[model samples]
Target: MGRFNFFVAFIFGFGLYFYFDQSCYSYFHKEASSITKSTASGHILAYLITLIPLLITVLFLKKKEINVLEAVGLSGSLTKGFGFAFLCTLPLLVAFSVKFSLNTGLSLNTIIINTISSAFFEEIIYRAFLFGILYRCTRLGFLPSVFLGSLLFGVAHLYQATDFVEILEVFAITFLGSVFFCWIYAEWNFNLWTAIFLHCLMNLYWLIFNVDDSAIGGMYANIFRFLSFFIAIGITIFYKRRNKISLEVTKTTFCIKPKDR
Candidate 1:
């Protein structure tokens, strides 16, 4: 019964997220395209509409202090997690800012709103809710969970993509991004804050400084994106090494028996 409950939770949560996401995206696209003057209004309404799932996710988290920060796992000691996440993203951030710089005129307020909204809803849905429930249900190893979760995350991005080639490219890139995010969340012991931070930085870069392939051709831009992928893998390797060493030291200390105290 317990295991079955987990399965049900995973399906329901994922289905809910997909439903709300597609609905909001479709509505916003239609509104934005149909009326010239409705662009801003459409966007705002869409943002609000997307918040419904987030609200449900928060209620589901069920912590006594139910706030966004707490529900999203941000109310922890972020000193180390923030530093690592920032460093991991710094290279790509610099590359995008220098090479793209397409939408710098976007107001700081708009950037903040989009960053917070996107990071919270998406991270909680994919990483916290879906991944968490799946891991519990399957009891699979970390790599397996990450692969399945990330694959779903990548697939979710296919809704708006019209071109077949573009869909493939988006899925491939987002799959890697999902792997990186799941790794980050695990590194922080399932703290959604770290994932949220890194994700926001990534989207902020693209949203504020969207890639202009004419300026930096597709091949070279892909190279830059791949660099970030390699860095994420490096971080995971480093984390494993560090944890192994810590475990060895702790085992040795345990065997010492306190010097006959």
Candidate 2:
């Protein structure tokens, strides 16, 4: 990775580490005990901290590399874009009740925050910059690029905790999702926004359905996860066979540059 990219990753890693150490437990405890105190201040700090590297990418590294819009798969049919977005989340909705047995009101905020902050920031860092750099250097095939990129994307989530099991869980799940995101972006010619939108929906479903029991509920969710993962594979293969485009070109988003004015 370039020095700039490495620096950005450092900033993201450190920021999340600090945020979790300082405030996450209190935040969770407050929720469990039914405390009504507003954490707006803390959340703001967390967001600002999280946004540092993302803003840097947006302002600097983005154009130096792939266009931000192209990184996450935006260049495609609108209907297909929306369909992919919704298909990703259909599992979550089907697995769990929309209205909860009890309401925490965390769903809206989770979706909003995750969609914008986590989804956008992560795509820029993990997929756009990371994958873009690797592809630029190696010109590897689609599978190689996505595999390495998604692994890093998921590996970075070890920030949530140092515990081995927790880390493994995060990596397993996040890695799988990162793979899916890579496919989605490929479908949309690396449109980061569409990827972010679909990512938000996918994670939103998980968060909402998992409000009470992520561990146990995860079993059920895993069923859907496996189904969706395989389904994505099928679609990816079908398009590969049907379109006759090289996976390399798809990974590169097939951005066509105009002649000099």
Error of 2 at 222 (Å): 0.6
- Residue-by-residue lDDT tens digits, candidate 1, 31-140: 76467455444564565566566557545543454565555556656676567667777887888767775785787556755676667667866776555434433444
Query: Which candidate achieves the best TM-score against the true structure?
Result: 1
Instruction: List clashing residue pairs in candidate 1.
Output: none
Model 1: residue 123 alpha-carbon error in angstroms = 0.6
**What digit string (tens of lDDT, one per residue) describes model 2 on residues 18-85?**
45536664555345335434344344345555445444544443335655444333444657656766
**Would you estimate the TM-scores of all the predictions?**
0.67, 0.61
lDDT of each: 0.63, 0.57
Clashes of each: 0, 8
Cα lDDT for residue 75, candidate 1: 67
